[model samples]
Target: MTKISTFQVEDANTQIVDWLKIYAENAKVNGFVIGISGGVDSAVTSTLCAQTGLQVLCVEMPIHQAESHVTRGREHIDQLKIRYTNVNSIQADLTSVFDTFKSVVPHTSDILKVNLALANTRARLRMTTLYYFAGIQGLLVAGTGNKVEDFGVGFYTKYGDGGVDVSPIADLMKSEVFLLGKYLKVPESILTAAPTDGLFGDDRTDEDQLGASYDELEWAMLQDESKKSVEDFSGREKIVFEIYKRLNFVNRHKMIAIPVCKIKK
Candidate 1:
């Protein structure tokens, strides 16, 4: 497996923080509001926003979230509060909201599709909640997706986690996010925890769903940049390259802007 490249941690942190501050200032927004999942991406994003010294509201929207996920999320919030005077937090337990949503929707015979739709629903619900807070607080909704998830695999839900005013860490790969996480002194629990979206309300991890680890995906992404083909690889490398290509192709729509039909005079 190819090693993921690293960068100078201090420079990245300073650059991202500076960019975030300038963006918010130019937009005439008060600050940034982000959903704080227990994952490294959210943790790192929130920390970067907090470094801007703007009003960073870390929100926890739990729809039957796993215990570990909830705990780490709260832990990061607490740590950020102590470290940054601009940080604040609140929790919106959406378990009942989700249950009510399920009750109101009609059931279909496609169990697999139903399950997937429900998972995406959880993400959309959280997105709505984030926007609600943003509306009230005059804050921009900061997205937590990283480069691998946003561009490499298209693993996030469209109009769900994909919904954001700005994405601070979307350009960074998963391994790079972790590097910033360590530099920012993010809590060890979150740093050590397996990366899970917690949308399904179960213990399934991102790797479990994607069929390849982020490290492998990052390597595959680099290889794709070099125009390497699966035929050039063997065994595990071939398997991982194939997985990367499949996800990239299927979710290409998410990576690009929406298409509009042009009118003919």
Candidate 2:
């Protein structure tokens, strides 16, 4: 396992807060907007923004989400005393969109593809909700993704959770984010809660979908090329490394900017 360090929390916090201040000022935005999904990432990100003493709006757009998820989200906002709003248009909005899609393409037989598309739609809807408030208030949409999910595995929806004006914790590993969350005094309930995207209505967790823990994934990501040879790893390590590589390949498009085609003059 990689020797995760706790030394960077203070420095990370200072850098993120400074980045937020400068970005918002330069953009001439009034505040920060974030979709609080009752996960540690959002909790820590929102708290960091609040620490900046900026008007941070934590919006909860629950779409067929579990009651516990909604409760945790609301609790975090109230605990922080940050400005917030709950847009409970989940059932109506999502149902309508799904119904329209079914009506338009009535013969789609691929259940997995359909399910994935709907899930991505949920994230995009939440993104739309965040931007709705951001637009009116002149705030930047703050993304809530850690390094492993955002870059290593690309475990976020493109133009959905990935669509944001500013990313405070994008550079920090999941472990580092937790340390920074503790340093920022984020609520214990939030810090200890299992992380989920809340896109799926069921109780699936981020780890469940990834097939490996964030720590394992991070370790795989940081493994030196000298360690890539099969002889260098144990059987279990090989399995984990394979999983990490597969996920990275599948989601690589999300990490890179769109490719542009230039016509030669």
Candidate 3:
């Protein structure tokens, strides 16, 4: 049997710090802008960016439905002493976007259309706020996606969370991300809590949507080189195959260079 423990966690602290410094110096940025969602990914990214000595402006944009969790997110961010802004993009800009889209996308269940549209609006508005701050403050938008989400499953929205100038941990897997978070001494409450994007109802979370535990997912993804091939498909292999196919299709656009037409001259 292939071992999941073979997935080693290396320290990217020095590299991340140097990268942020070079990016700031090259772009002449005064700081960085990040979205804090009370999740490990953003929290860890914000911390690393802050450690680089760049002024980190963290925005907590929450819907009325997710305010409590956002409140917790805010408290967690405060513990890190990162400069922060609480922008309620959901109830205002997000709601408006949903209403506009629903009027044209064919009448459907308000719950389904409203929820999906609202999620998209939330992502777009958050990016708008990030860029707005970046413009005013001369900051770069730092992305928080880990390797698993960025590569393994295309778990982000285009022009949404995917719209970042730099990704600090894009090469690290989910397990590696937790290791780095622990290495950075991030707070226990934020580190140990369930992973989520806070895009749904109060108790909603990412694992529930994926229909598998993070551990189970990671186990399936940690395929050994020797174990390659459909022959290796065994327990949980079906789950891995389904996930790989779905995310692979969903994120195909993210993996490509922008299409350009070439004319025969």
In terms of TM-score, which candidate is strongest?
1
Q: How close is candidate 3 to the true structure, as a TM-score?
A: 0.82
Once fitted onto the true fold, the runs of candidate 3 whose alpha carbons sit more than 4 angstroms away are 1-10, 65-68, 82-114, 224-227
Clashes of 3: 0
Worst 10 residues of 1 by lDDT: 1-10
* Candidate 3 CA-lDDT value: 0.70
Q: After superposition, how far is residue 194 of candidate 3 from its true place, in Å?
A: 1.0
The best-first sequence of candidates by lDDT reads 1, 2, 3
**Tens-digit lDDT track of model 3 for 1-265:** 2222322433377678788888888998887888887788887888778877767777766544465566657766777773434221222234455456546765456787767666766677778878887898788999998876776667776788888999998877777677777777777877778887766555767787677666655655565223555456766787665676566568778867789999999
**For candidate 1, what is the TM-score?**
0.97
Q: What's the distance in Å from true for residue 86, model 3? A: 18
TM-scores for the candidates: 0.97, 0.89, 0.82
Clashes of each: 0, 0, 0
**Judged by lDDT relative to the true structure, which candidate is superior, 2 or 3?**
2
| Candidate whose lDDT is highest | 1
Tens digit of per-residue lDDT, candidate 2, span 1-265: 4433556667778888898988888888787888887888998888888877777777877777788887887777787774433211121235465456556864468888887888898888778878888898888899998888888888999999999988899988888887887887777887888877878788998889888888888888887333575456788788778888788889999988899998999
